[model samples]
Target chain A: GESVGLHLPTLSVQEGDNSIINCAYSNSASDYFIWYKQESGKGPQFIIDIRSNMDKRQGQRVTVLLNKTVKHLSLQIAATQPGDSAVYFCAEVISGSARQLTFGSGTQLTVLP
Target chain B: SQTIHQWPATLVQPVGSPLSLECTVEGTSNPNLYWYRQAAGRGLQLLFYSVGIGQISSEVPQNLSASRPQDRQFILSSKKLLLSDSGFYLCAWWSDEVYTFGSGTRLTVV
Candidate 1:
């Protein structure tokens, strides 16, 4: 079975620095991508999403870049704050199906002061 | 605004005990419902999905089963839970745009 994976299990960053988390998805058929942030003991909150037709999309202090050629997706956060410390996950959806989503292993982002 | 609700934030069940987790969505109708399980420090795994009432699709064959009795209610159940069933169970709803996940339920089987 194909799966999505994170390049690193954990990422540490200093406050005020930019943070980037990477993901690789095995399903080439995936046409839609989304980034989610989950704080401890909470449900995942949608951060941003990008469709296959576009290469990049930006939201408040966050940007999502998708390189379909390499089946890679990355989330970039600016001015990392201690409050930004959480687990980030990327999910993929195929073209024909919007009912199911494939999720990547999460990366724990820890911000250091 | 749509919202998802999952009950029993945490549960400790003895092995072989029956299991039931309920999920409901509000402010949305005819939306697709899904159940996913995440093991400790692992990615989310799709377990089941429902497009409509009485229609259930099992993604990965296992001891788990799902049912949709109403338009916005989905249930995951097992006749006898296995020790391996211990994990975090998440309920999600999908609209035309994106999916919304519920506060997951953590189940610990002894």
Candidate 2:
């Protein structure tokens, strides 16, 4: 049962606006892709990766968009602050499996003020 | 500068008791170790993984168990402690470009 899901459990931006978090994957040989940033208690911070041959990848202000036809994966946060809120994860790696990482179903970004 | 450490950040075992969770990695060396679990809000749940020292790979088979003697060390065991084993416990390492997590261990199986 290969699964990695997230269609937005929660997300709200305002600070500087511009934010988008959405992920949907079921593993189609998943070729490495990651985006993580979890604050609340820390642990899980590495915010940009894409390697299904590469579709898009940018860091600093964050940006990762990979749509292997439709597996879909996106995370873009340009200005939104408030420490950028919290929880945001999307991971998938199964191209010979370097160490296995299949995460998703997490999106709770609340930045407003 | 690489670092990853997981310990008793919080734990309160009970229900049959018996469990150990510890992961260590510093500056990397033969790196590639992971153990993740998260419940409260869901996501991140890839049980065990190791690439050296004794070698282990179990993506969830229940009861839980994992160990990687040394070489950055990694261990997660359980002989009992059910109650769904509470939640939150992460330890990761794998850097070609990313993945470095620790500072998480909050079990509570009362």
Candidate 3:
């Protein structure tokens, strides 16, 4: 039963502060990972993605870090804002199976004023 | 700009009722289509995927089935709905190593 999981179910961060969310995946064959943000009653929006060959990838105000040694992944949002409050998910694509992505349970991020 | 459309944004159906959810992709052709379900406080679960027309792969054994009648059209159906089937259903298409999801359908089986 290979799966991806998050370390925290919920997170609270002060506005303008940096926020970090962590995830752990059990599949060693995973070659690609993605981070998504989903607001209430909306579809998950792609934030950023990283390949197994690279350890980190950065996007606008966001960064994704991958640790193959420990099968850990993290998403960092700089200058967290009220609009950044949403449920974040981490998904993994296994090698040779690019059509499907195994998703993590997701972490609810709440930005506080 | 490729976009995915899923219809019946919100649906309320009684148990044992028939169900049909349609999804279509625009601005793209022969793209990989997928159906995923997200329960309250849960992650996305892959229900079905189609790489091409008339080709479907089921990820989970459930009371649901999918069909790809056209290159850009994917449909999810069930002869009789169940209470456990209630959730947020999402349709997605793969492009450039990323998945673009539709707004999603909130199905509430009473």
Pairs of colliding residues, candidate 2? none
Please give, for residues A1-113, the per-residue lDDT of candidate 1 as tens digits: 77788999999999999999999998877778999998877778899999989999999999999998998999999999999999999999866654478899899999999
Candidates 2 and 3, the one with greater TM-score: 3
Per residue, candidate 3 scores C-alpha lDDT tens digits across B73-106 of 9999999999999999999998666679999999
What residue runs in model 2 are displaced by over 4 Å at the alpha carbon?
A: A1-16, A19-30, A34-51, A57-74, A78-85, A97-99, A102-110, B1-14, B17-36, B39-45, B48-79, B82-84, B88-107
Q: Each prediction's TM-score against the native?
A: 0.96, 0.34, 0.97
TM-score of chain B of 2: 0.34
TM-score of 1: 0.96
> Least accurate stretch of 10 residues (summed lDDT) in model 3 chain A?
A93-102
lDDT per residue, candidate 2, B14-107, as tens digits? 9888999998988868888989889888777888898788889898789989999998989999989899989889999886656788889989
Whose DockQ is higher: candidate 1's or candidate 2's?
A: 1
In order, what is each prediction's RMSD in angstroms?
Answer: 1.1, 14.2, 1.0
Most DockQ-accurate candidate: 3
DockQ of 1: 0.73
lDDT of 2 by residue, A16-100 (tens): 9889998989889988888888887667888788889888888888889898899898999998889989999898987764558
**Candidate 1 local lDDT, B43-101, one digit each (tens):** 78999998889999999999999999999999999999999999999999998676899
CA error at residue A66 for candidate 3, angstroms: 0.6
